[model samples]
Target: MSQKAIIEALKNPDAYDEKVFYVKVLQTHISYIFLTGRYAYKVKKPVNFGFLDFTTLEKRRFYCEEELRLNRRLCGDMYIDVLPITLSDGSVKINGSGKIVEYAVKMKELPQEALMSELLKKGRVDMNVMDEIARILSDFHKKAETNGKIESYGSIDTVRFNWDENFDQTREFIGRTIEHQDYSFIHRAVQEFLKNRKDLFRLRLRKGRIKECHGDLHSGNIFIADRIYIYDAIEFNERFRCCDVASDIAFLLMDLEFLNKSDLSNRFLIKYLEYSGEEEDFLEVLPFYKCYRAYVRGKVTSFKLNDPNITEEEKERSKEIARKYFQMSRQYAEEIF
Candidate 1:
């Protein structure tokens, strides 16, 4: 569909004017999120990246359903269903009995402060909340599925691949944006640490420390409503979701530090280790995984600089966010070595 068509669809009064319905646009980044009364509808953008494939109507529908199914594991009562949007002649209608043109995952919207990210920003986050989150995530990881076929996911090769991808893609940006001394320090730290810790990485794999997990478990993806709810998992790619559990937790750790709550981050890590009894293993592989997580954030935010949809001011803001994440990755690497 054309950009104008998409915008028109978004502005369609009939779609939101039903007596029983009310629509509000929530967020429009990688995907479009809309709030319809108590329900939130998420529609995948028609973009084809090698990592994610939402390019076709059929694929979008399939992934929309997949998102509902995967998210239901955590938010069973909140994830309602997946609905199709049909186009006939020139008009669009949701769940119409015509050819499916697009798809959206429908969900019950939670309160804004219920989101851990928003809570952290307002200084409402606390250790009790972190402990609760730790317990919830630990239990989830214990029950998460593991792929018996992918040996690489638990091996040194996976660790190496993570680093190689990060360094190769962000070296130029890091060189340009970061101070020379800071950049060199991080580079030497990563090299030395990886050289000396190859054996530890392999050992973690052999111990079943790697499993399929929430690929993106940062504060933004978690909700604290009576219980911790983690949603919006990596439904489009298995590689993103399947890996060492430490890698999964590292995302949260990186997010906490990014929010300037290092004390809480440390407390959360310790509590998670205490509950899961996996502290030693996590300590061994955490630095590497945390660095990987930070770099991934940097890489993703950097794409905003190239997006035509974003204004110049937004692009500058994205660049600053990307730089912050790159610096965080460097700091994690230095702390490890």
Candidate 2:
């Protein structure tokens, strides 16, 4: 079946195992999420960007399973299972006996109002919530699996490679979403840090700060509910998922700051340090990662301006957000002292 046909088929409440009164579908560039009354099913697009490939049925199935496995680290019960959409007799039924056509990662749906991003927008997030977020993040980092290979990602060379890639990827958006001067400054600042902070990067590696972490650690990926749920981890690439824990921390911190909650970010960082028992030196390397995180956010948001599916208003918003992120990246670069 075609991807569009399968998507249309899945929109029926009858397509699910449990009773669902209605079905709503959300589409991202790489995946489609069908939200039911109690569960959400995510299906990968048969698209291959160089960094991620879900072009083949087998690759989609593999990533569906990988998403379930990796996200189970934080949301074991929420990431329910990986199910196949099968085709038989002109019928497309999920997990039915037929030719496997597509795969989906099924998850228990949580309250949308409880999402960290929503809470921030509603002004419902408090210091207590930030406190819990910090404690949970510290514990997760402590338990995350790490080895020699993971630690190598914290090396200066790898760090340089990532920054260089970010710059190259976003070069086209310089005048559209980011100012040329801001881009040049961020690039130069990152390069200077990589050249002069070899000792600091080596210390992070030696102290074992690298781990298999949640690559997308932002407000949108978190929920403040009965139990905190941090979901939607990066599963397509280990290079993105396995990194210096500081990078993971920086992503969330950059997100809070992006949401105009710099106080929360500052408080979260202090509490995270206290909970993790890391030295004050952790601050020394944080700005570098924060700058990297903000620049990457700018790059990705700017790309939405070119997405044919996104509305023109969304593209305008993306351009505005991307500019803010680049400016924040510049500020962080300036603070790299």
The whole-model lDDT of each prediction reads: 0.77, 0.88
- Per-candidate TM-score against the hidden true structure: 0.90, 0.96
Model 1 Cα lDDT, one tens digit per residue, 120-207: 8888888998898888888888887776754467666665666666566666666544555666766677778768887877777677
Task: Give the Å shift of residue 192 in candidate 2.
Answer: 0.5
Which pairs of residues collide in candidate 2? none
Clash pairs of candidate 1? none
Name the best candidate (by TM-score): 2
Provide the global lDDT of candidate 2 against the true structure: 0.88
Model 1 compared with the native: what TM-score?
Answer: 0.90
